[model samples]
Target: MNSSIFTPVSPTINTSLKPHQNPLILIDNKRVACARARKHVTRTKALFSTTKEIVLKEFHQRRALKIISGLQNLDKYDVASVVIAADKGGATHVDIACDPELVKLATSLTSLPVCVSSVDPAAFPAAVEAGAVMVEIGNYDSFYDMGLTFSPEQILSLTKETKTMLPTVTLSVTVPHTLSLPDQVKLAQQLEQEGVDIIQTEGGKFSNPSKAGVLGLIEKASPTLAAAYSISRAVNIYVMCSSGLSSVTAPMAITAGASGVGVGSAVNKLNDVVAMIAQVKSIAESLNLSTIEEVVFEESNLRL
Candidate 1:
């Protein structure tokens, strides 16, 4: 073995350095900083679970399905039905109102990862402690009906505060559809810079579709799809296109560049759990078919 392989080279001495500016000490400090960085990364990775791994894998494959039971929904029976439907219908995870009891109920009902949603940063810790592996900072559909809108600055502030509260928990922040598409993209970029793991898009309630059937479904999903397309391209993080999505438009969401889709009313509005499960299954199948079709097209291109 070469002696150089085991030897440490002395850094060049700088004559401009003050007495306190020791080069060796600076090198040691750098090593310490690097070690601290590695430790942070390790700690962050340690937060992942087998369920989270599966959900993330689905996102990477652009087939992730998240069933949302609604952020304001406090009805235990309704939330429980949604959670069960999400699991039986093959959804990657289920998102419910951020309550410790709801989190516990969701986790107990299914093997899928449970994500809690709330606007309150302080409420997340308790839900995470109760069993929610992921936390979402906004699910503002109900708020929209109440004439509340979150500005981009407000969202960025919320993201910062949420991160401070749960630095290691996987965070997904919604880019409010109230903003113009350009503003949405800008906010998503800022959220990504804040270390947010996922960016969710919403606009279902704002849309007013004139036509019925498939045309109406496409129109209803347009705002969120557009947001997904713009924001997904602007940031490296995952974009979950949500709000007003149906089986007809869930696949379209993937083509628009979302890593996943979140369905709320479409799955949660049904009175019967069986109907909820059927809706979830329909959306899930649409996403899977979309994935398969894309794969075939890519393979065909390779052959040519």
Candidate 2:
């Protein structure tokens, strides 16, 4: 990590994402700060060690999918339905409320990494104990209706506070869309400095798509894609582009520079697990389009 966490790392040509890619990250005088990030992330692999390799492989491929069951959703059946769909549909992970019992429930339902989302730092430790593979600090959309907002300073302070409480667990903090793009960039840098493993960007609720059909879909995803494009370029870690994303714009998220994407309503808003899984598979297929296109390209070149 560089002294300035928000600065770009040595940009490597990402022509492909390999299943067994090496995890070694080299640090020069430029990124001495990220040295600790490399060390701690490795040490903390126990949480998702079972699926870490695949999760990261998909991330590097820019296809890792995280199914969200809603931060405000508490009905066990509803959460469980999404968890089942996520596992069956090939998501890299699942996110639910910060409730410990739900964490346990979600974990039992699927072997995929179980990420718990919350704004409350106090809710994390117990959830971690209950088998949460990763802990997240923002899903601010849930609070938007209540007329609440999380300022950049408040989010950063909460991140620092969460770090103090659980130093070794994988921590993912969301950069509130409520902040200006420049402020979002600054906060993401500070979060990188804080050793956060993943930075999530959200903009679904805030974006009001006035257009209809595909145009509307793109309109909805524009904010987060803008964030992903800017932040992924600036930071040296995974950026989970989320909010208002659909199959059409999902591939755009990765192309825009996100390592993975957090999807909520696309799956959660569905009425049943079957529909949820179908949505999940649709997304998985979309994200897999790059690999498919590459294979076809190689085959065509051979034929030529």
Candidate 3:
């Protein structure tokens, strides 16, 4: 909650893929080009390889929902149920904590990509060996309650060290939302430079924002949303907006330019897994529409 760090303004548009610079944009295999004369022809083989091979190389295609089980003792049935809920709810991936049994069980139970969350650098390699598709450097919200703090330098160093050790595994580093927004942005840029694949923002600790009403919810989530907006713009990697998020603010995150989102308490806190999945799907649909509408409006404005 540093006032000085909130100085940067949010971007008016998502700048990940600029249309003017890359005029030949492809959508579902069809080329949408403004001028035939400006077209840069390529071999069909090259196009096919670029398209199909790229998809095949990645772990998953959709924005993911990483379910974290809050069960006291990690049980196979509980892990299985969460995975089932995630799959049925349309999650592209699931993230479990740094437990070996849960990692093995979750991987065996589902086809979706799995991620492991651990603060220890030593545990990352073992988590990867246990079949985690990605390794997250945090769940900092949990640590914040214990009066712990993570510095940008430590995050950058860990990222470099982690990448050096686990070269092939995808890495998602959480930008400690507890830090000032500028520090968050700086760390995000550093992580990107360190070759981290995904950046996630969280805002549940340091102080819990009230969840009583609309205004209260916004108050609670503004920090994470601001982090999402600033960090996503500063870095080229995917940013998963998280913490204090609900169905209402999901689209807001997308409009602010998050490539994805991760919800733990919102889903795990619920007693009914089916209802949780439905709510998560509703939020996902809202984000999908928001992204499409933004793209369409940008395309239309370009035509004008």
Candidate 4:
């Protein structure tokens, strides 16, 4: 057996009167704080895989675009098309169903970080082992269509189980739009306390648009937008505005304070892979344009 690699440090304290006279020289608080900051950065880098760190950086820049393959979608060809679109279209990552085979297939298709989504905590470990860089607790729209709903307590329970299983893997949990806005904020806060890396908001299934064209698009996105606006304020973690969003509302999501946006039906519903790529590229370009406009507006305000 090899010897242990632990190195022990001396514990002696020098209590001379001269040491007390120049305490700042003996212990520079600024240096200590900076060291701690560097350690934190190192720890975060270690916690997430390199691809995940890149995704998080995009999130921090408020420009992350995640193309989601439905959680219930099992068709390999469909998943492949979606993954290819995300990669060619400039999305930061792709979210797919929590199946190890799908995880493997998605990884084979794109260099983007693959995020697996499921309400079942037990399903995440196998997917993570299969090469998924991140795990999500929901894309609860499918469950809603089945007339099932997730309560805040149940969501918290699921989050706890997932963290226990994969403590270091990046986690994103969706806040169901079925709950009241205040309740959504409360759940987001609790998820943050549980160390969830991201919070996603959804509301398309519940929205009933009253108009067509751009007005309809805005109407469809209102629920998720509201949830993003409310939950982003309530939690310090990044919020991803998802469900019912289009290129028209994608920029609005950023303005609503989301760190990023997740597009699913908007891309995945397309029968042609080329159309899917076009849609993804459109949303990505919209986000970029929005970011530039935000910068210009801020500069103009400063000048004023």
Q: What is the lDDT of residue 98 in candidate 1?
A: 94
What lDDT, from 0 to 1, does candidate 1 have? 0.88
Could you list the CA RMSD of all candidates, in the order they appear?
A: 10.4, 16.3, 20.1, 10.5
| Cα RMSD for predicted model 2 | 16.3
lDDT of candidate 3 over 1-304, digit per residue (tens): 5453323423432244343333133332243353432354445335534533332232233344556554232666666676777766666567777677788888787877777787776777776677666778877766666788898888888888888887656788899876888988988888888888789898855446655787777777787888899987898778888787777776677778787777777776666768777866766565563355468899999999
Kindly list the per-residue Cα lDDT of model 2 for residues 1-304, writing each as its tens digit: 3353322333362323234333243224326767778877776665456444544666776667999998889999999999999998878889999999999899889988888999889989999889886889988887998999998788888999998998877788999999889889899999999989889999988899999999999999999999999999899999999999999999899999998999999999899789999999888888884456568899999999
How would you encode candidate 4's per-residue C-alpha lDDT over 112-223 as one tens digit per residue? 8899999999999899889898899989888877889999999999999999988878899999888999989998999999999999999988899999999999999999
**lDDT ranking of the models:** 4, 1, 2, 3
TM-score comparison, 2 vs 4, better candidate = 4
Please tell me which model should have the higher lDDT, number 1 or number 3: 1
lDDT scores in order:
0.88, 0.85, 0.70, 0.90
Q: Looking at model 2, which ten-residue stretch has the lowest summed lDDT?
A: 13-22
For this target, which candidate reaches the highest lDDT against the unseen true structure?
A: 4
Worst 10 residues of 1 by lDDT: 2-11
Q: Candidate 2 — which residues are off by over 4 angstroms?
A: 1-57, 289-304
- TM-score of each model, paired residue for residue: 0.80, 0.78, 0.70, 0.80
